[model samples]
Target: MTRRHTTRSSVPRTAVRVLLGAAMTWAGISHLTVAREEFRAQVPEFVPLDPDVTVLASGVAEISLGAALVLLVRRQATVGWVAAVFFTAIFPGNIAQWMHHRDGFGLDTDTKRFVRLLFQPVLIAVALWATNALRSRR
Candidate 1:
């Protein structure tokens, strides 16, 4: 017997896509300006790149991913994969920050630092799932 396929709706998918896209876009902008210094402080010493360059590159990458997420939301499966991959790509920076345990960037404490690290993966999963939902309908 063949299983039935369900048609996907675009309304919910568009809503989620817009939200994640706008949020990440804003986050990328913040990293480039308002939070640049804070991000600079999070760079790991062993990353083998200049702090300024790293921050700038990261901000650009973030903005690009955010744009992609927005544009590709309708292609849920593809966007899910892309977002998941992007999230994994940035894991190192989080690990570096947690391991280094430095202060003065603007974080309240080491606990906050580590907590933020833990949240990255979760955000990725959400992005992936939201995108996937959008894709399923198409």
Candidate 2:
């Protein structure tokens, strides 16, 4: 037997990719600036690097990855792989912060903090999936 699949319209596909890219790009910049302290507060105490440096470096990396996602969507496979790696790389920071969980972020408990950490991976997955799915249509 044979199976058939439909493709997304160009407008919706373009909208999805562009919007995802723009959102992530803005978020990355926010990480570098306004969110830096909040992110730094979450940095696990055990990490050897200074919090400021770690925050700066991570922010820069995020910005770079977000840009790549935007421009590289046409070549989805490459962008998808890079996005996956970037997401995985930063996960430790999330874990560390959750482990330390000292309030803020309006969280009532450490468990809530941990749940928050899950947001990163989920977002990365969405970004990667959107790009890859768009690629599949071509």
lDDT of each: 0.74, 0.70
lDDT of 2: 0.70
In model 2, where is the ten-residue run with the lowest total lDDT? 4-13
RMSD of each: 4.8, 5.3
1-138 in candidate 1: lDDT tens per residue?
988554474566557767887787887888889888788777778778998888888888778878877886446567667777777877877777777776635556788878888788887777766776444546
Off by over 4 Å in 2: 1-6, 9-14, 133-138
Q: Could you tally the backbone clashes for each prediction? A: 2, 0
TM-score of each: 0.77, 0.74
Deviating ranges (above 4 Å) for candidate 1: 1-13, 104-106, 133-138
Best by TM-score: 1
Candidate 1: C-alpha RMSD to true structure equals 4.8
How many residue-pair clashes does candidate 1 contain? 2
